[model samples]
Target chain A: MPERPGQAMQKSANKRRATVADVARQAGVSVATVSRVLNAKAGDRNPVAEETCQRVRQAMQTLGYRPSQVGRTLRTQVAHVVALLIPDATNAFYAAIAHATETALRERGYAMILCNTSEDPAIQDEYLREMQAHNVAAIVLLGAVETAELRTAANSDTPIVFLNRRAPQGVPGPFIGIDNAAAGEAVGEHFAERGWARIGCIRGPQTSPASRERFEGFQSALAAAGKPLDPDLVEQGALTIESGDAAMARLLAGGHRPDAVFCGNDLMAYGAHRRLADQGLSVADVALFGFDDNPLNAWLATWLSTVHVPHSQFGRAAAEVIVELANHRGERMERQILLPFHLEVRASA
Target chain B: MPERPGQAMQKSANKRRATVADVARQAGVSVATVSRVLNAKAGDRNPVAEETCQRVRQAMQTLGYRPSQVGRTLRTQVAHVVALLIPDATNAFYAAIAHATETALRERGYAMILCNTSEDPAIQDEYLREMQAHNVAAIVLLGAVETAELRTAANSDTPIVFLNRRAPQGVPGPFIGIDNAAAGEAVGEHFAERGWARIGCIRGPQTSPASRERFEGFQSALAAAGKPLDPDLVEQGALTIESGDAAMARLLAGGHRPDAVFCGNDLMAYGAHRRLADQGLSVADVALFGFDDNPLNAWLATWLSTVHVPHSQFGRAAAEVIVELANHRGERMERQILLPFHLEVRASA
Candidate 1:
């Protein structure tokens, strides 16, 4: 029986395991040449002959030697690791973004460390500290953060990128996300174009830039259409299903029922749909508009009209910018990249 | 401004930051005393005054000293990290599991590294090698690795635990999951009791042990109830929403169109529901059963009947075992722990 085949083979092959010196000796090359071959750091510096490279490869195969990634990372001063911090990993929108970002990062030979903050700033700070301690190559933040604090903590050396949210002035990082103001304007125009006059808005938490931007855009669009802003028609809640349900209930009880409703996100829209259903009112009775065209929003039972933000594109763009920043940390940084959004007209609105 | 108040302050205040020597100096004791204080090392070879312990704590606080987790882990042979290899992060079921596992591990002071394999064996090997190289404290594998070649490479001093799947015999790891066979039997009995004589099963892929056990249990239950196993009613696919939709379409196309369907997971069940709705079939008319009572299953529209596996408990138990092994690497290991599952009867069934 091959007891511990993997372990025994590795142990018995060579007691000390092949080092750069051993490979150099076996391949009849200098230690520097062996290091260059193993680390892929030669890069037009003292290029080796094709025959010598082949001999080095053969020597490595014979010795069963695997180069140390940690050592290489330290020597290069690049960890090849990026940290992604999201408010919640269970949310489909964020999960999809994380999936896309992970694929992009992997293609670029980088590993991602996923941290779930559950919308708690303390947890976010802890994760940020941990990432800094690990010397993460770059960071992609998906949720809102206090601008001054985040900017101070991030400093200039660490490349930071924002996704689904915008950073404050002078943050020195690229922001990749949908044009929230445009999305909100589209929703407002859709409601107006459909001749639904009375509109109520359920906004996300006040701290989020996405929420604030959308609210401003919606208000501006309504004003342009000669409609006065009704404070009684607005309700504020967290961007969660339960919060949405609660906000909708409050709107219903306040006696300012509108014929149309615009929600901050799809999860909230689903909650509003359920609440309306519970009240014996169908979604068709009140036109509903949601943002972030998540997968669940397209279900047959709930064909939600939503602003389709290109989630995958957002992720890919963020990854590309961060990778560039990682390559050149001290260069002048790009400010922001606003991706376009489309309106998915479904039966709901 | 407090520059990097968390860890950086401590590192900068003292030239070398909180080393074993610094701790000893503050405690008015030997270097070994501080090492014992941090590691909780066994054997009390030195005695220190209670006042001295207090002074040590005060000094650490004043200097903003945080112990080097890396150094302690190195000396104690405990990395304080666990690697979780998941099939996919986009799947809500898997995401929920990963979320719960991460929370559990974090509460126990263990960091989790989530690696998405995308159901590829080669990628799984790459992640396994990365984990081994990091000297992760333990590993929790969520997918099946059939080939002995890959298994042979997993020989490490770190403990490993299998989740949602069973490893081959003599594999050096504990298996933590529900009794899939029993859950399937329960599903079969539920279908039979509900008077759905004609039933179809959207079985998972054959490579997974959970799928095999579930199929066996379902077949055994049907046989005991005098219902012959109908080969035509079975459609094989992966445990994904798209696969479930394809499998359902196949079943409908076949001559045997059962009134009820049992899906391998909740995502698949949701897909089945979507397909049925597209075909103008009401959920109430055709009963559907799913496994893993995911949070989304409890939504009003998708009140899916499912087998409730304590996912959080699974994570907690796995972390506990890993922490135990990390603390005592040489101790005799426990082989397996089977968790209990319950049937959650909802509107679908």
Candidate 2:
């Protein structure tokens, strides 16, 4: 993913100030090497030869280049900035991850620029472009926009670590998350053990791999238990309370209401619970299960039984992965770290 | 306040590339004028004189200066970045505000950097320093650290707008929020109407102005109604569920279980509610009033009757105030904009 020398120089020359890219191009070295030479810690051995370091330093002087001083650490030449992109900040699940990640990053001497794309592809692309311009050390993505632009950006050399998601097909990056399919299977197993014949599920958008996997796993597990999911009971929501409410209502109106229902997330569960309550059906009458056990769900007067995915661990892992990637001085290795998830039994289901 | 010419030049010359400050000093003009000339929009009347614009352009050329392309808009010298500093992101009240503000800013072609200080003064100081380094256009603060650094920074030229908070005495800035005292009085009146004699209150930390105001108003209203708050019934918490739970426990152990209780915020109410439930004391047995009618309260089976401060409005107002200040090229103005608050009567009280 290293930039072509001609392309790097051409882009830099077009600007009045010579960027880090310009120094790399002029010194006939990679951007990483130039960064290391300029920002090397006192005890760290120089990866580049002394003469080569001098050459890079001289090129920087000749081009009037200055390292990004705003968030740049003089010792490591790494920007003190990290960008955290989430789909929705208002969602407690993502908010918890963000809060944990920000705390972890700050502890590591990095300032995070938290961006909420609100699940929009265009905004995601725009924020990625902005991050590129700022020369951030790394980016941690809690959600992704699966578009050509995202695919292109992911293919680039910018160090990225995704939380709760894998890089889309054709893109390359490390990821840390729970096994969505396995978690879904756990829900199915639980329902089958309770001998619930008519089961319903509300899924997220199909574009999300996590959502797709969850739906697939749940269906497969039910099929194995001789009770395949009824198409009429299956509904899709956009992961909002309103969507969940509407989806639940649709499921009920389809002639057979599920004795027990599984929601894609805790927010949807809350919505589904509300819809049931509105229809004079109590949670005790219809068992409810949810994924992503946000703290709010447990604290509610009526707690939800859900798949407890450790969001704090997901966030801390993301920070650690990015830090490792940023410090790596050679070819990048692809990693996929899976965290554990368990079903939390509560009163609702 | 414009930087002194000598100070600007000295600061810029220490780096390799000449900054915007360097160009302004060389052109004998204010940084705002230099910014305006370089990033002028189509059909917008040039703010600087033609001759002065020429001098600025020449200075840029001579010094090889480049504007920050990462998050900067060509139409305004302002960086496209705005930092929203919140005390806690996990708290639904703050999360709602953060979400609304981010949406508003994004619509105005600005990206938001959300920072969670976790209500720690040290972290607040660290974040403020980091924001200063990143050169954000404006900062909307949902919380503030009462420190000398914060006081000094407020007096600087960086446009700041306080949301749901007032600038500490010496730190002057514009603010947008509901009248906390009035909202507290409303909660008190509601309790008074119910004719609850033994009213216990759980207040947030004394350092929080919002918390202090709420306690004062609630106590005064009770006195006005010929019923005064018992000194033994009062407890202090950190506006958290644990704090609320412990405070409620203390009230019960004091051999005077109140017929009703008031919490400074919804989070504390949730805690107190949980504790009462644990003791087999249903909310129906004891009326509870909470400030900040967070959506969670309504979603819970036992709803909370509390003051509803329009969080979305508060967020939008913060964005508008900053946008106005950014667009104003002349002197800065300090204005206190008060929004309305109302009682959202629900089931718990």
Candidate 3:
């Protein structure tokens, strides 16, 4: 898509096009070194030695190796582009992470390309293949819908890092996220102190391992507090406002009148709050709790209580690990990197 | 960085490597046809005739061709990656547009790559160069900080589309955005209907043309209503809550007791609202207005009256224009496209 001169295709006497590896061999340097020189600028922090850069240029001229016509990306290790695959970017939680990750990647001398998968397995698989074909240096998965495809796609050629989401069992790449069970336990304890008798759960999709873990921790905490989460009170669906509203309706339609509700995420909590408000009920009548302290909570959802995941910390850690893996090829870092989470007490719960 | 078999690099007797173009020549078809065959799956909607695809495969097999050994991105017109450059994704306004654009692009057989510039000229310039190097099929710009650089970067090779922001003068690209001045007039008219006196303005940075245009429209409408916007009541800074709050403080500290204030964006209005609340005042005491009815506005900022720029419409329009440009290379389409805007009168103004 970038411009190349007409002379690049005009061959003299139809000679074979020289490759970047050929130039590397002639310059007596590694392919990576040549690639770094080609991609980096004069005052770049990478700082390829001027003398060696001159040698590479001289070697290129002698071999008539025009970088434009040589298919440079095919033979080079410096793609310099990282792909971040998330389920949805419209969510404030994911947007915060994406913003932080983009900032961190820019600081790490790499560009991030964000792809939204909308929690569709086919879409995620297609994006995985597309990233491979595009020669991205690395990938960061926030929440993937297809684990087996991701497992098969993980290789030394293109490293993958899971952020704020657990990777599949035995996935080779590093997984960087907060401990969901601990965070959920914290939320449950905070809600438990209120002494609510009937605590209902509006969880995310059943396929999400994080949701199940959080549900388990909440149940255990509630049981320890002598107010267990009722099995008939839990509803699972998409982690969206519409789903939360539907689930809240279902919970209220039944004979059991829950005094408090725990939502999978803050958006769902917002939905549940609005749903209650529509029925001439305030949050004080039925407390609401949630996870993922969205960035807009202070301005918008001031009354809802939720858990705050340090979004920037998780993004920075994920980017740092991916960069490390990219710089040191064929290397594995920590298998699981955990960050801290916070529970914020607000008016709703 | 995708995995390639070891045998791809272990050359057999040092023979010359074949190229995709070479295979196309051998198969008696265009290079694009061969690339389509190579990248498409068995059930793709881009129905390449099975007979032609078979001939291309036969040609490749006869020539000992391995796609992993070739730079498939180069020498082909099917990059299929449309890059959307926005100021920030954390802003719910931009995130809404991004979500809509991604859905449209996926439906059109393209993947959208989102890059956040944070309104930094240097970062935007660097991302422009990076996108070119990565061979993105097209680029869509929203609130670009550096216009001259973007004008120079636009070309037929990778078509550019200006989205929700006007293009630089003489730039060769389709500018698809709402009429900012008209939207400002609508806001001003709505505010005028309230019969407020001594209206103040918390404007965005002076460098933004849209902000200037909006101010002009607002001033004109205020004048038409016989209540002029005082120059002493205006303060300009970053379009963020901090700036808006500081601007409001400056307005009050300067002895300008304004009954209403206009913020350049919704988040700024939220700031102004909070600033008033801190002083034991309310929106009814000093009405506040804003633009960009963010997705979370209904849930979070229920009282802030604002202009609603249809984010999904803008996103869908931009994506459609870019896909058309990418499919029809070297063809100049419409120079400017305008979408509609609406003024949402909420409790704040």
Candidate 4:
């Protein structure tokens, strides 16, 4: 049988964890002295005696004493945790964003609790309530839907940053994201420049702000080229590869066979690519473009032309805003930050 | 300009959050009564009066009061949070495991704090220390290397579950993983049955137990069939797509041109496929096999024959073990749970 640390210390069946008090007792010093030695706050004029500090360190090492962050958080009334609410985990776009955000947050001494809501309103609300109830230091919502419960939670003391998504009007938080309309317009320009007459589009849900913006901008760009939108060529996807594939299949099977198609995101593009290939139709014949240049685009053999939304930049920018907001809680500051994006034209288009 | 919540709350320029005391005051009840009503513990014969309960609920709603979990945890000495440490987030294999683990943990009423170690030992150590300090409910380490600090942490009171990785001997924790050797042997049998000679292998670092086991089992199986292993045909990869590509390039550029190759994981296999395609060597000519049948296998056009480890099952089993150990902290329980695996034969083989 493995001997637990608690039991190892007890020398009996009864087990308990070592506390600061135990370390203090072992070091023959006050709990405050031990804490002072351990914390070693900067700018403190009076430092602990070297011998006393050494004794405390030795005592801690001997007792396997690890200071409890829970106790510290209780005293400070601020958790060193940040809750990241994302729509999906499998999507490479969100995953890359998460990776970047986690890296940035770790550098700033904050642990990230990732919540995959999967576009479920109930799950999003539940996670929001939990983050608020836990008093997490900050909350970052990436491509999340706005709800009354979320708006109410936004009124709490916990700092909030909207990453790749904007909260409802009147909500206070920094939203760091690319201008989707501009990116969409760039894609539209690419298609028009390529002289593709019959165009099709696969957009995300109507409720999604980013999707709506992209669709509107694409329409505006096409109208500028004297090509009004064709309702028959438009389809709504659930922002998934399967949905993209189905949408592409519908377009291919429909009367209006478009020579070009722009997907809402890269995953959808992959789906479109697969579906097109399955039907013996090639991406070269139907120029395919996607949004969010996820890492898969660079790795996969199918080079998808995409509007690159610098996910790492968004992560770094959101971290900066959230950390700034956390440091200046209750102080008015800029609550919106828009980043730049580029159109990466690859062989697929 | 967004009207900040702090300013909105402060009609008279002084703002504060509504607390339990405020709720109790509004409900005309004791704090303890409100606590009991809110908690609603099981088998509590003395339930709060229906009218009082309604009043308390209404008070809570009107005040927008959210109970702080920090206070509850301080009192209860346990957090409703678990930490999942992964070596890489972008790797589809680890991502699938993370997604599954997070879903299982969510079902069990535990929030998951994902730590992306990125295969950095320093980062891993820092996260381990942070998880221990935070006193998270439990810690789930996915494919972590054994270290003295980790061993010490394993001996702590927190329930730990090693998922897809085995701890060194005498480590106090439950390890949940598939029998890699058996899985590898299955792959070897497939190769031998196909009468494939000149078999090359790309294994992960020697430090990885899974890699070593797979390589060993493959060698053993090949030797059992009266076919001795060729040391020159084996190359150690970094378990990445790029590494696999480089390893494949080396094999093809070298004198020994193996007709068949087994990669450590799917990412590496993807890399090898890309390199082979670039070199005008089709997968059809050089049979390629991989491990970890992640979601990408189904999405990608190339069907890769690989060993399926049932990642979701591994996650569920790990959660079960961790939850059980947490509930029975000091009790002697099963410390190891070995899962079964099978070889998934796809077109690439």
Best by lDDT: 4
Q: Which scores greater on lDDT, model 2 or model 3?
A: 2
Weakest 10 consecutive residues, lDDT, candidate 4 chain A?
A3-12
lDDT of 2 by residue, B1-349 (tens): 1111321101111224355789999999988888789778778765677899899999999985655544243233346678888998888889889988987887776667778887688888777766755556788888786887687556555667788877888666777887788788888888898998789999988988888888999999998998999999999998888998999999889997999999988888888988999999967887778887786665653478788888888767877777777776233556777788888887888
What would the per-residue lDDT of candidate 4 be over residues B1-349, giving only the tens digit for each residue?
2222433212122246677899999999989988978888678889888889999999999987878778877777778789999987777778888888888888887889999997777888889988877778888999777778787677666667788877766776667888788778877777888888788899888888888888888888888887766888888898888999999999898886888998988878888998999989887788999998877777673489888888888767767776776666555453667777788888889
Alpha-carbon shift of residue B284 in model 1 (angstroms)? 4.9
Instruction: Please list all clashing residue pairs in model 1, or write none if there are none.
Output: none
lDDT per residue for candidate 3 within B1-349, as digits (tens), equals: 2111321111112234456788999999998898888788777887789899999999999986655411645656345677888999988888999888888887786766678887788878767766665567788888866556676576435567788766665666677777777787777777788788788999877778778778888888888888878899988857888888888888878875789888988878877777887888898789988988888787778777898888888877877677666656655554566777788888877
Tens-digit per-residue lDDT, A1-349, candidate 1: 1112222111212133356788889999998888867656546767777788899999999986666445554455456678888877788788889888987887787777778888677777766656654556787888857744586545635567888887765565667887788788877777767777788899987788899889888888887887755889898878778888888888888876788889998888888887898888877677778889986664433578888988888767877887777756545465567777899888888
| Model 1 backbone overlap count | 0
Better of 1 and 3 by DockQ: 1
Question: Residue B205 of model 3: what lDDT?
Answer: 72
Q: Write the per-residue lDDT of candidate 2 for residues A1-349, one digit (tens) a residue.
A: 1111321101111223456789999999998889889767778864678888998999988986655445243333346678888998877889889888888887886777778888788888877866755557777887787788776556555566777877888666777898899889888888888898789999988988998888888888888998989888899998788998999999889888799998888888888998999999977878888888887765662478989999888767777877777766233447777888899988888
Ranking by DockQ: 4, 1, 3, 2
DockQ of 4: 0.35
Error of 4 at B127 (Å): 0.9
Kindly report the docking quality category of candidate 1. incorrect
Per-residue CA lDDT of model 3 for A1-349, tens digit only, reads: 2111321111112234456798999999988888887788657877788899999989888985545411555656346678899988988888999989988888886767778887788888877866765667788888966556786676435678888777766665677777898887887887789888888999887778888888888888888988778889998857788888888888889878789999999888877877888888888888888888888787668777888888988778877777667666655444667787888888888
User: Pairing residues by index, what is the TM-score of model 2?
Assistant: 0.75
TM-scores, chain B, all models? 0.89, 0.79, 0.79, 0.85
